[model samples]
Target: MGRDAPAAPRMAAPAAAHAAPAVGDADRRRARDIHVAIVGGGGTGAAILHDLTQRGLRCTLFERGELTSGTTGRHHGQLHSGARYAVGDTDIARECMEEVTILRRIAAESIEMNYGLFIALDDDDVDYTAAFERACSESGIPNRRLSTTDALRHEPGMNPNARHAVMVPDGTIDAYRLPLQFLATARAGGATIRTFCEVTGIDSSDGRVSGLTVRDYRSGRDERIAADVVINAAGPWAGSVAALAGVGLPITPAPGTMVAVKGRLCNMVVSHLHPPGDGDIIVPQRNLSIVGSTQWKVDDPDAIRTPPDDILRLLDRARELVPAFAGAEFHAAWTAVRPLSGRTDAGGRELSRNFQVIAHASDGAAGLFSVTGGKATVLRAMGEAVADDVCRFTSLAIAGRTADTPLLAHREFFRRQERVHEPV
Candidate 1:
């Protein structure tokens, strides 16, 4: 999940199209004639590539290392149902709910509809139940209240002293596979993907983006690629990417530590009944049960380390949710940096989890856009928002259909022989 992960393996044959007919020669020609270069190969970039290519725009994606090697690969893998953020941010909660429905339709293979439980362990947690359930309902998230006996029966492993509980449509997400599905669908639409290619410079003219100068890590060679637009979707590193274009972006790389224990102590995603906080959520990924996370601001996303204290603290918190968590063998621990939308001096808890697409025209870098913030749950919406902004900026009349379009299976990404650049 770090910057030094192994290079992505070579993919096989092109995936079969699930959205529309195979792109025609004329369509590809038109797409190639209006080039767009995306800087990042994570979920956001993958979705953007799919959207733009479907709208008949030629696009190329550049990644400094392997795809999903950064925050995307390290995600906690919780398929949020908007319940967690309902109390504080209704808009984000609703967005998560909306995207969950859409993603379940398109990327079904990458998800586990196992559902989740928010258990109240104490008087405070019990008192918060009413507000929590109300917020969820206002946000259109279905929540079913349960007695402690019923809750324990649903998840026998949870803390026996749990006073109350609520069920939400939360599930587990294959973070890596979901993005790969988007990338595979994009390839079928005739978009080019270049892994191990790092964007070194932004070529601009008359205060507008012109192209990109990239270093192909595989070949150890630098090459100049022309483009009409350049989008920075580098997640936690988006601020650095924008700096390359001489644009100042308000992005905070807030890192959180997560620890995974060996056994699947809980089958359903278990969360604290109170407001979102550190180590309050535990998600089951296959045989491993993961508890996370403690957040704090960091200047560099790459320089982060899993603090020893966070590990102990998270395990302690996990014990409160599921007492069995204390005895489960420790599996692994890691940190993931969140690309919070604002510059915060605190632990970034005050910042909204919502996303924003900033067109750098105001910063004298027209044709250059940067999208930051948002969680994996609403990645498609993030792409749709950014794509709409890019289209409006370029005065292109293109409508996004990613929501209604079905994506190819995740494994199909490796099965597709598409336009992947082979470094010479």
Candidate 2:
């Protein structure tokens, strides 16, 4: 989360409403006064709102708590180059590469292009490293193999037993800054944002979404906000939002936990280059290191919390990679649920990392859409696809120009940076 603020007054009123004359009208007169209600305020939701507002559509972002008080705020802060997914999910890898390139150029102040190291700590994995390099290269992710001596020279803190290493174009990001940047630009474009507002229900009429019922957690007052379309960008709680609409969505919550060590144990993001498993990546953040994560399916997203055992497991694995990390002081820990879609028949781990944009027509519902199951790195592209779908459904003539537009001014990013930390 960026910084906390005192509560503000609610929006003056729901913007003017536009109704569809018929179900299949070709020139379905667009909602001139388009008020889009987004269900989350994390990176994905914020990006969606920014995309909508950039296209000249009005938006109201509803957050249950502070902005980025979700997965976006708790991530390991690695701005991927898709190298992590290159071996298994090439599609997601390509998308990540494209998005990371775009984000680095547009949100320069929010990102630290520190690059990343994928190391093989044992001789048994050196062959795997060769294959990994080939796969990353073929997937268009820049990957270069490094000799053991050269690798150790760059990362003396790395395991002395490391047999091989590959440098990929990954980087650390200020997860908090990126979403706030998106929210700030969205607000500048006339979008209204409400925090501590929990969406209670979705009001529909004649099989089409009409409005939303929201309750203020602090004030204990409920209000109905009219909208032409409702987008479920609720992160791990996306399924819950769909349930409020009486729609059954199959989103499984996969809980992952991260622990913050008191100091930077490594200057670069370090990965074991193994398949998705327990704490295999260590990311360096400001004044500390974020080591994560353990992935397991969970029944509830909201009930997630870091367990003592999880921290112990992470510390054990972290020490195996960097000996100094064995005694690193613990700062804090956090857990977030990643929305995973698929079934037991097809292992969830084997499920595609690509996002699914499900329009309601297939589910016998209208005016409701869900964008689910994608990593934070590619939120921009996912946002573009979602905004385009919304415009198509509402017949809004506004052009989708978010990809070309920078989300924040350089001056604004630096100004906020000065306020958040002591200047060097």
Candidate 3:
């Protein structure tokens, strides 16, 4: 039931090939082959920078705070195998399934292939198991069912009341480390990663984006950065960024709250076999077993609070899968805003998690684009899709190598430039 674009104020049309933005001598920017300005330094932005830089495109990425300060900083960190959404959304399910293997290959060091267990706690869950399995099979998400006893043996903390269980390829991830890897690789490949930089204004001329005005949060100094193309990968704040160019991005900030508890409640990720619901999934990360998430619509991504009721509900639901969670003791909690691709009055859960890359030329603004929606699991794919738009706009023939190449270690991001690439 997740919504796509065309929800409010009308969505932009798909761009026609060869309609790249117009660049002129008046545009003030660094003298480079082709410069792409990336606004936002989260997973999506970092991925875009990685893809473009690997293809020999120069890129400058700006983040208002630290790299993972936005929605990227706070997440459930589930490396989705696409099993959860297979029953409802085939496309997203397939995307997750395909990306899982790719990420395992490219970012192996940051992903935990610990696998996952879906427990059906009641007779209703048992009856729904067949449908779930069918959907996973149909969506190409490999899975195997397990007996209640066998399942408990694997996860000693699993609820004994569980009637059925299914094993999925789901796992945990280092959300921050993964993106930092992307950013680091991009930097090693000659892209600039700027932290504590806020985009203050987007400058446009004759319906074409010329550049953006950025302010250093530390220095309180403004600088103008021009580029052949400007990318809006601002996540939940994408709409506001587009507004600076007098464009309507049709993005709704859907915020979800996740709570982490002390102690690892299980050895693997856990979830309910039923439809997507609040607090239905449990992910064991390191020494902490994190339970998430409750979705709600919010206007401002920055002005959100984790509701006490949400924390209680999450604890109650998580305990159903693992009784140990009932008294695990609270560790940490936070809210993350998802930049869902459409503006709708629909409930947050009803909105789709699919991503959309919009070319502003279709909306009468050239040289600008925005990418929103999807989760951490599909970040590279999201970047590839958007990088295609950027490439087409720049009239470059470079193909994406993000899927094959391992990133430069995050610690080496600022070291002497080195290219991270794999053989074609």
- Total clashing residue pairs per candidate? 6, 0, 4
Q: Over the stretch 254-292, how does candidate 3's per-residue lDDT look in tens digits?
A: 888899999998988999888898999999988999999
| Candidate 3 to truth, TM | 0.90
The TM-score of candidate 1 is: 0.93
Q: Lowest-lDDT window of 10 residues in candidate 2?
A: 10-19
Per-residue error at 166 for model 2, in Å? 0.6
- In model 3, what lDDT does residue 254 have? 82
TM-score for every candidate vs. truth?
0.93, 0.87, 0.90
Which candidate, 2 or 3, has the higher lDDT?
Answer: 3
Instruction: Output the lDDT of residue 55, model 3.
Output: 67
Cα-based lDDT for every prediction: 0.87, 0.77, 0.81
Q: Compared with the true structure, what per-residue lDDT tens digits does model 1 show for residues 181-258?
A: 899888887788999999999999999999999999888999998899999999999999999999888999999999
Q: Which ranges of candidate 3 are over 4 A from the true structure?
A: 1-32, 414-424
lDDT comparing candidate 3 with the true structure: 0.81
Q: By lDDT, is 1 or 3 better?
A: 1
